[model samples]
Target: MTRELARRDGLFGPIRVLERKHDGARLYCINGSLQTLMLADGVSAFGYVHAAKILVAEAPNVLIIGGAGGSLATMLATRGHSVTVIDIDPAAEQIARDFFNLPPQVRWVTADPLHFITAQEGVFDAVIVDACDSSGIVSPFDKPGVIADLLMKACPRGSLVVNIVAEDGAPPWGGWLAAKLASLGLSVCLFRSEEGWEGNEILHVRVDGPTDRLAITDLEQRPPEARTYLMSLRPHVASHVPVPATSDNGAS
Candidate 1:
């Protein structure tokens, strides 16, 4: 009962709509030999859009991993923030351009985020983690101190956020991962949706300020209905997962 819808957006090379869902239509990029799956309306691109919408300031340097339909990238560009998005899937980049109307201010890099983060030296005002494994895993590349160190080293007195998929009340990584990051001196905050699509976590790591003073209420402020939607996706804060540690520069 599923089929590919034809292209309509001229800006995007070749795009298609898979089907209509509760939130929006599932989208894809059909320009190349490979079919790149894009967004799932209310669900697939929801987390990034919500998070991006509440960003406190316009950042000159920003890095995004797992450009989901380019929602976050587009939103940031519209707000006058320079964005660089890295995705392992070229199809994803095309789909984001074609279907989500991602703008050119959002530079694109087709590469693995882990490798790129390790190899780069540019410090950013913000770093976003939206990477996902094909097997439905979210960033299994854990070395405890690497993420904190990277953000601290690369960001200039700014913040970093990572999205996770878990149930409400789930202890993401049994609280070990978050704790490790905190021990390294990054202010942390957790955000979730009521719909339970994917457990979203927004961890704010401060570079040159008191970590405890960083306020999360601003970025997370939402209307009752919106809060309801956010609460729906709250991963169980106590849920534990097997986060593997990498040695010698985070290479598998």
Candidate 2:
């Protein structure tokens, strides 16, 4: 049983209904703007980046680069984390508020992430990036460097978290991205999320280090819980590889 999801007036995007298993809740995918994936438990998953927050024992200032259904934002807020979410599409933010019950505690900012951060200097403990298509494919945004730069500027030395997607033969950005962070003085660790098959990844970069780099070999020695969590999402993830450190050029 499928139903037509509500469409907002003047909202610029394609709309479709997506049904999930178990309770059979329905979600609305707003195409390029955002997607509302219904969690089996009557809640909705905003399909944005929030997995990196898992590493933090306590939530800090959390920034979300994309606003889908506001799932991750809400989760962070619920856990008492000061969260701010940004999205270029106003319609997507509106829809998330209307349908997914995005909370008032989660500040919603409508602006380009790069532009917003360029004019100011701030820092955060965590940053999530979970925006994608309904088919579970990652959508191409602007330069990946923009995000890398934002991570460098907004996060205190050694405290940036980037959520990425893991795929089979996916050209191992784990090393490349981590290396970029390392060059910027952030020690990096890549972990697979417990949410399996969602292409979910959590890359944690510490801003200040002892200059003793965290080799990919050390990542394999993580506790069983972390390894089990990562493998759950990326069954094909082999032994870790050294991600590329950032170059001094600051290209991102």
Candidate 3:
């Protein structure tokens, strides 16, 4: 059941605050399609809930691009991680604070994430990016360029960046995305969140280091949806093996 409780036309686009019976979440669906941000039982109803659990395992210094509802920043800050959110849309700050109960500890900077990161010349232990709008969808932040920029913004080594992709089937996007991350020298683990929105996948990129399997069983601090998704994962990694050399008779 869906009911449009309230809505407003703002700089980012049409923001419709809807009530969903399934999760009891007050969802902010941008332009009647994408559920960009949400709040449930005073907690985040967005993918960041899952992200927070993932970050808790590794990231301490968190830099969030595309502030959106400020859920990610709020979530990380409450966990004692240094959090800073940069968003191009100024309205998001107000919306986040006014609606989502974003905490005061999380700093909000109104600016284009790309420009801000380039100018600051800073590094972070973890970077969480969830910048998507209602219209004109593209490969989660246009994978290549943003991924490259994100990797640079990461610490010298062992820094991880998580990109929440609204993915679909496979092939060009999924396969190509992995290839791009690999080429950029980042070991990537694509966690498909089948329980969340359709085609939801969390791509974790650890710059020049090994990323362990997501601890789904350890879902103490995570949300119900997140725990369900994580629990679905059995914790494993794909091993790449080269073809063995053949001897005299084409058999070694």
**lDDT (Cα atoms) of all candidates against the true structure:** 0.54, 0.54, 0.59
lDDT tens digits by residue: candidate 2, 1-252: 555556554234665544545455557666533344545443433221323445443447877777766766776677788888888776667776776677888888887766776765667766666544332224332124654666667765535555554455454554455555545545555555455334555556555543222223233543332344534432121233543232232344
Stretches off by above 4 angstroms in model 3 are: 1-6, 19-24, 36-39, 46-48, 133-140, 166-172, 194-198, 217-222, 234-252
Instruction: For each candidate, give its TM-score against the true structure.
Output: 0.65, 0.67, 0.76
lDDT of 3 at 118: 74
What are the per-residue Cα lDDT tens digits for candidate 3 across 186-240?
6766555546443445556666566546555546755555555555533223334
Candidate with top lDDT is 3
> Model 1, range 46-76, lDDT digits (tens) per residue?
5434554454354667887767467667667
Model 3 global lDDT (CA atoms, 0 to 1): 0.59
Of models 2 and 3, which has the larger TM-score? 3
Each prediction's total of clashing residue pairs, residues at least 3 apart in sequence or on different chains, is 30, 18, 0
Q: What lDDT is obtained when candidate 2 is compared to the true structure?
A: 0.54
Q: After superposition on all CA atoms, how large is the RMSD of candidate 2?
A: 7.2
